[model samples]
Target: MAEFLGYENFLVAADGAVRTVRPEHLRVLPGLGEHDGEPGSCDGLTLEGVVVDVAFRGVDRVVTVDADDATGTTVRLTADVRDSALTASPGDRILLRADAAHVVALAG
Candidate 1:
């Protein structure tokens, strides 16, 4: 079982259904405001979404995803070496860390 440490109260079922496991769920992370700081750091939050686009560079990979949250924010993810080669396509469900900073997509 992969435990989302920072999001102990936020759980998503295997069928993509989201539910609040606890009443204080939303208060787990309080520093993720839109303008509080930079993006890309998952220190205080976790995000789940579907991959909307993907591009690969020499040894780097970039992914564009639309989060399932109400903000409807589009986030770009930089893949680690292993993740960079994973077979990801549009609409593939994924779980990512919030506060992601560098949202740059790789050039095709």
Candidate 2:
């Protein structure tokens, strides 16, 4: 079985020794916000990326992004945002924010 550790920004897995933050824990917003290149005052984990895909699902909008991680490697992520809240299209740059409170630990 895998052991897990939960933290404010991410989750730690025992055997794999990896940290992860799920899509549900992230918020996709248009990069045009006041905090363009940086995290907003209330953000816990912030990431800037280019929109790779966007799909409408009823009241939600599913967005996929290709963001550079701390090591400059591209990381692909998907998140669901309110349809009305996302104004970005494919090829647009956007911001992803995850609040500490929403972060959780999961078994690998």
Error of 2 at 63 (Å): 0.3
TM-score to native of every candidate shown: 0.39, 0.67
* TM-score, candidate number 1: 0.39
After best superposition, candidate 2 residue 66: deviation in angstroms? 0.4
User: Tens-digit lDDT track for model 2 on 22-52?
Assistant: 6656787776565655544263557788999
Query: Candidate 1 clashing pairs?
Result: 39-99, 39-100, 39-101, 40-99, 40-100, 40-101, 41-99
Q: For candidate 1, write residues 4-108 as lDDT tens digits.
A: 432233333333444332212211121224433445454534665667776665665555555544344343333332343366677777655433232222222
Top TM-score hit: 2
Cα lDDT of all candidates, in order? 0.42, 0.66
Candidate 2 stretches greater than 4 Å from native: 1-17, 36-43, 104-108
Model 2: weakest 10-residue lDDT segment is 1-10
